[model samples]
Target: MTKISTFQVEDANTQIVDWLKIYAENAKVNGFVIGISGGVDSAVTSTLCAQTGLQVLCVEMPIHQAESHVTRGREHIDQLKIRYTNVNSIQADLTSVFDTFKSVVPHTSDILKVNLALANTRARLRMTTLYYFAGIQGLLVAGTGNKVEDFGVGFYTKYGDGGVDVSPIADLMKSEVFLLGKYLKVPESILTAAPTDGLFGDDRTDEDQLGASYDELEWAMLQDESKKSVEDFSGREKIVFEIYKRLNFVNRHKMIAIPVCKIKK
Candidate 1:
């Protein structure tokens, strides 16, 4: 990956801000509303949206969230508020809502399936909350997903965090997002913290779930782009490459459009 100090990061920062401003202006919307997950992706994206000098509402929708995640999210929002007059934040604790939802839903016998469904449920609930705020406030929902997560592994819930009006950092890799986050003066806590979806309400990092770090995944993505076969590698490299391939295959549906059965015209 290229270093952070390159001119590309600066250009990307300016371009995204300009793109967002034009998008809002064209759509006749007020500004952007984004969820802050105490992660670098959200922090960087929200900051870029704020730089547009448009109203940027940073929403923290915590559903049985970890203490560190909550703290980092609050701190990032606070900093953005102090730095940008157009930036404001609100916290919507959804613990009760999630609990109520679980109570109403039928239980599954498989623990893994149950846990995965509940995790996705939490994300969808947050997405609904963001849209509620957007509809009332006339703002667009800005997504925090980066390149590796959004396209490489598809490490997001469909119609959940993946459903958004716009994605500000979707083109940049996780490493590049950190570089942009650093340039934007994002908090050290967030810049240093391991990346996690925070949807599972646990400290398990993305690596823990994906079986590969963002850096490793990034390399695998590049190798995949070159059309390298699994037979070309050995040991841990092979293992990581395989992990990347498996996720990309499994989540390809999330990355593509909903299939529409076409009536032959």
Candidate 2:
């Protein structure tokens, strides 16, 4: 298995900080707006942005989020010198939109589908909130997705988490993000906290939904890309491979650019 060394982590930190500065200056933006979920990805990304010496607005939008998650998010923000705001509109916004959907589609009966839709709605609401602040402040929204979730398994919401003006950690794998988080001196609570989307109220973790740990998933992804056959993998590796394949197929659309219709010549 490939491992990210300390030197690589430091280099990634430097590059990401440089990218943030260059992108903001070129776009003529005043600062960065990021949604902090208390996850390692957001923690690392926010820290990197803070290190850039640019104004960073860390907004915590919790929709039926666990108290622990919210606490951790607040804690991480406190550790940083950046500006932050807690937009506690989850209950009102999520309920209103969800009820509107139910009222509009009274015939819809699939519980799973409804739940998934509501979860996505929650994400979109957060995205909209971030953009609102960004627009008013002339700041760019910074996405916190890492390489594994953004490209390997495409685990982010379609225009929700995926909707951002800049992505700092999208090129680093999940494991690499953890390494960067440590190097950046992220709060220990946040660095060790289990990653979650905060969309599900019950506090199910990312691994709980993805059916595999980030390490296993990363391994499977690398092995798959290396063209290793299933016959070459052990039983556990095979299971990881299957999970990777299923998630990649299911979330492929999020990983690719939007399709455009071309006119016939």
Candidate 3:
């Protein structure tokens, strides 16, 4: 575990912004498109893209189950004053999409799959919407996954929230993202809000799903750099550890591009 220069907060922020600028220039993207989940990761990503002088198109696609996050999503966009569009993909659309799959195969006790499918559908739909506007507007799809989630546990859905042309904060750890948020001067309330997927019913958080809090995860990831031993193994910690071990396959199969097999003579 290599440690990024903790001394270079300003440098890191500048480098991130500059990298985004280069991508924007090379890709001929006049703006950036992001699915704003009102979560810290998306909030930080969207705000950074907006502040970098790109036309940030923030999309809020709240399912019927997550109608409550709608207001919070809108509030963040409103506060940012970036060009935002709210698109709702509620039960009607989700049910419509899943109808075909369910008809092909019988539903099972895998309620997790059912819930994840609904959630992932919303995310992918938002990505599709972003690309729709991006193509029309000559913009790039900016991904919002951070380092901790990207490396540790593969916490995102494949072809869902995982699609993007460029990720502005993929290198920043969870704690570093918070620091960047402060550097970007994101609103205090959003900065302090609990990180969540907003896919679950009610105000359930990502920490709730992962078992361990992001704060604890961040501490462990950072501290593990030295010859540090894990002191406690909570149920959540075990789950997260398993996810970390499994992320290689998750990313290789899901997030990565497919490899073509060639026949040799």
Evaluated with lDDT, which candidate comes out highest? 1
Counting clashing residue pairs in each candidate, in order, gives 0, 0, 0
Looking at model 2, how many pairs of residues clash?
0
- Write the candidate numbers in order of decreasing lDDT: 1, 2, 3
Q: Relative to the unseen true structure, what is the C-alpha lDDT of residue 190 in candidate 3, on a scale of 0 to 100?
A: 67
lDDT of 2 by residue, 68-127 (tens): 988888888887753333211121234455556657864457888878887887788888
List model 1 lDDT by residue over 14-133, tens digit each: 999999999999999999999998999999999999999999999999898999999999999999999999999998988999999999999878989999999999999999999999
Q: Which stretches of candidate 1 lie over 4 Å from their true place?
A: 1-4
lDDT of each: 0.93, 0.82, 0.68
In candidate 3 the C-alpha lDDT for residue 206 amounts to 85
Model 2 gets an lDDT of 0.82
RMSD of every candidate to native, in Å, equals 1.0, 3.1, 4.8
